[model samples]
Target chain A: MEKADHLSMKDEPEVQGEPTKTAVHLSTKDRPKVPGEPTKTGTSMVDTAAAAVQSFAPLNQIHQHLCAFHFYAYDMTRQVEAHHFCSHINEDMRQCLIYDGPDPNARLIGLEYMVTEKLFMTLPDDEKKLWHTHEWEVKGGFLFMPGVPEVMQRQDLEKVAKTYGKVFHFWQVELGHELPIGLPNLMMAVTRDGQLYPEMIKETEKQFGISIEKERESRAYMKGPEHGIHPLANGGGKGLKLELREVDIKPVESVPRVFV
Target chain B: MASSGDEDQVPPGDPVTVSTLVIDAGTKIMQRRLPVKQMNTHVSTFAIYGGDMSRQIETHHYIHRVNDEFLQCAVFASDHSDAPLIGIEYVISDRLYENLPQDEQKLWHSHAYEVKSGSWAYPRLPEVVASPELKNIAKTYGKFWCTWQIDRGDKLPMGAPELMMSPQGVGQGVLRPELVKRRDEKYNISTDELKQRRAEIAEPEWINPMADYWKQHGKCFVLDIVTVEMNRNEKFP
Candidate 1:
């Protein structure tokens, strides 16, 4: 099958091109009228994000790449109601993979993550077996950011572990020659009980030492009869295509001794 | 096939009867669009923003402030990439559009969009002011979070005050009986002429498109407001 033509335009990010020689600073006063022009925080940021996507793209394309490399693999079995698992799937963050095809022949069509008041429980024997598993066998595909770095003087990682019970790892994926700043290794955690995957920012702060300013969350919705297709295909095309809603959060300056 | 009222549903280009009475009403508008350092939605969808065609499109609730009769009127959905979405268009009374601050103009470009197809266009208005009852309806139910579609009993004319009063009008106007007399008697201005001036002063490019469903049903006019809680992301108060 010929791949969709529009796919290239959608997938090819502007950052993929060779770095522009001209620098573009975007201070509030000097910012251009253009709404979403790329920032000139130097090439490192661009190169890193591009590299992350490049690495992720291929790995994601091959479902068993990790398994072929000896990583333990499991097909997302049937989707029962949201249940708590000690692994990546949990009550607060229940996710199931929807395959476009029923078997290996089909690609992953969509992923649904749900968080609600209902909580899922786990069995003690199952928890023990999962805990004994080695690091080499476990592999996950996701985007991560470090919460605190390992070298930070405050030992923020320890604080995070104490505040939000933790069980996960962190890594900085190098994209070719460039060491991206914001696109550094992700700080992530997989729960023994599938729940809110606590972002591992504490480890990031340890390495980068309090560089990030804030945390924000956003929701995206596609308007259509075809569900996911662009609106224009449905006849009600508009210049503005995407709708994103956002949430604001204040950052913690330093970890408190205790939660009030 | 059901009620006599149901039999008179609207068909495109077909003249439909509108009763003076207000029928079913609802609102569907988004609140203000805050300025964020990162416009991720724009980037993800348009692959363009802050560029030459980088126009800011802020959404807000449509309010009616006439008597204590605030209400929601209609709901709109269109794909503007084809042409501007069309709800019954109305010209706002110049007096009302002019009252809006320039900063607001900079913020809420007031254009409508059809979700299915990505298109953008300016709405044409017949007049600025709605009836005192309509204004009251908007004010009472006009929340920053919702949009509304309405049906009054009358066919919307293609002109000003009459068009605004047409089931789908969203323009503001002077409801005081005395002001109406003064503007008309002293200035010899018909409601249409006043609306012409109103459109000039306000220069509003934004208008809501009534959903095609409402248009077909022969709604007198449509009003749309978007309520905040309706947003799926609104998990907390």
Candidate 2:
């Protein structure tokens, strides 16, 4: 996990004056030209034609937008801002599309799914380690529903404060890799005070014209989990990082087919 | 600010909350964006761990084909409107799979059997368009992860995402017959008929041996969180 210190914050430029919280776009340099000449006319024409014929009902149901920050599970200091366009799979669960930013050039870097506490406590010890409690992120003022006000956001925040998320980040944007070049890495959320860089929080507050202090105060009355945070979760400050290892697929007696 | 119990204690099943009051008072979300409409194709299939076919999962994939060679999908537990989000999968052509480093190749599984066995189906799309697409997809390989192990009845997605493999070949250790029957009945289709219907899709000239390495080698890749270095002070230092 100490490999996390290798990530330098300078890779991602600061969030500037965003007129709206939903303006989660990043300020980055222009793209370098590719060898082939670009042709937008043909692309747009196909998109228009396809739209005239195709059905997009499932995608249409995705409506909620939540923007937050995720750090490489191994490194507490390295962080990336992610915008989640989510839809309810069920009342107990939510699936989201995690993008690095909201710009046209932005990359869809990861996928995160959330579940409430009643379901969370059912996980085994080892399994719990893979999930992070959202209490700190919600109660700590680091997570928000972008354009929604606190009053409207609270109903969901109350539910979220007791939930957990498992994030799989396909792109290592924090490493400054222009392309998604590596296998996915598990990502985590900040669970305690002092872990988030002071300046980073200050920049977001200034850009959005919102105060983290006031956000915490507004959510003060919201209840914390009665069971408390799991000790094995969030790497338990062990500086966790996801890595791949080869293992034998366990041999099992196959269940014979009961029907044709 | 809405005061706590300073007002009457809210009754059971109360329709009015501060949120409803705020909404009733004309608060609105002035600006918002949702860019996920790219997903269009929906296919339902089954997947099993590369190591164990005894444990199987029913998957609902809402896909967006990026180009002739690539596609990404969001996976859910079922086709039921209320199904829980389960995981994600990315499918790539043989050309891309071959170019990947040897170690990376071991992580992916071929879709040939899934297509040929009639296990993978586009339930809603017309067979005319779906047939051509299925033929092209049969030659590709996919790598997926299951976050919520609903098959185990965990109620929530737990643990790190479990890397999944598509069942290749036929019989016993491969896709189970009962599971196939269940899927067939749900969609009002016959696996045996699909097996015959898709029989004409020509098998690719070659599938990388490294792909689906476990079936032959008995080994699979797993996600781990081995502490690379101690963040705290070490005795050696």
Candidate 3:
């Protein structure tokens, strides 16, 4: 079988003799004046300068990319594809910055923090409801991390299966907002069949050249959360509703030790 | 997939005889780029919690300039390769910031002090190449959040996220001498010297009073998360 063209892009990072560089001239007068040109150029030039001296220690750790879908807590009917660029802080937790697509032009939509079940239980009841479980996304093969082998995936998926994530999205792409204008919205993951758009699943499968059915079969034996998901999680099946209210920032005790 | 059985198929006398390498060589690699790959710029600075100015953390920002209107960064605890990602910051031009409602404006802070005090650093860039751009960033506003307080030595990012403020005026903005001295030693650049170089860039007179609320109004904003009925006869807060 001929592999999917886009899937080949992930499987093979660089193609030999394919002349990847392309340069084109632009007629600036033909279009409306674009904004922020100076900053963009400044970034490129400064990044070039910084690249010679400073090391990007933390960013270099983001090697894993997971493809999944998310729903707005206020309205589960609105869902979107979420691509996660993640790194492990430790076995107990992982943090990820999410974007709309995997390509260079993708929009950065939000971020997420995933914690172990042990840690999840430590949270206050109110805080726990803000998070969603990942058992279905993993065991049902709704979530996939590309480029790694099945062996490596199974190893990580085992841990991911038991984790819970709290996500916030700044961009309302589903609402057709041109810019990220409003307050960030809380995002949740669909827990069962028919919740996620099936078309997205089919599209993800086509683009990655993988089988969700096969993945589900292999992950069937993995354990779910030991005590089952807390009732408070996923809005307690009450349809999570999010709101922003003003709260006072409390003061922390001053550090007694002075910086000498 | 690279096969263990293909170990013998590697070209004879090859210095690195790996089964995976042989398979990779046969299939070749493709050039595929990602959005995060364009995140080449790095800025190092410090931020204080909005609710309390005493709680501060050193921030390393790897920026991806989306356009003229916004520059978002993935923040880390340290400059080390394995440093934890402590939070995220969304920066915007003064024009875009001015358009935001008064309440939304409170969530952001100004960068004039960070710039004027010479506290922000461009790490590898020479002062000459960076100063011009730093001048532009000096007038901008930033909304930063620290998911986990690395300074407090938390093992995990627990509790709700904290909204961070940039040190502003003299009484409200003085950073600990130790933090300054340590940052200078790591980058080997004197804040005093950078301060002098940046003095010519006058502060923006139009800084919104709504911004840097902790500094201006003596209070800070906190995240309020709650679950209510979605279809209730009500409007969003």
Rank candidates by DockQ, best first. Answer: 3, 2, 1
For residues A178-250, could you state the per-residue lDDT of candidate 1 as single tens digits? 1111110101122222211112222222333333222111101111111221121101111111112211211
Query: Using TM-score as the measure, what is the rank order of every candidate, best first?
Result: 3, 2, 1
Runs off by more than 4 Å, candidate 1: A1-141, A146-260, B1-213, B216-237
Instruction: Provide fnat values for all models in the order shown.
Output: 0.00, 0.28, 0.38
Deviation in angstroms for A222 in model 2? 4.5
The models' CA-based lDDT, in order, is: 0.18, 0.64, 0.67
lDDT string, candidate 3, A53-81, tens digits? 76776676565678788876766655677
Of candidate 1 chain A, the 10-residue stretch with the lowest lDDT total is A64-73
Which docking band does candidate 2 fall into?
A: incorrect
lDDT of 3: 0.67
Top candidate by DockQ: 3
Error of 3 at A235 (Å): 4.1
| iRMSD for every model | 29.2, 7.6, 10.0
**Winner by lDDT:** 3
Tell me which of candidates 1 and 3 scores higher on DockQ. Answer: 3
Residue-level lDDT for A76 in candidate 3: 61
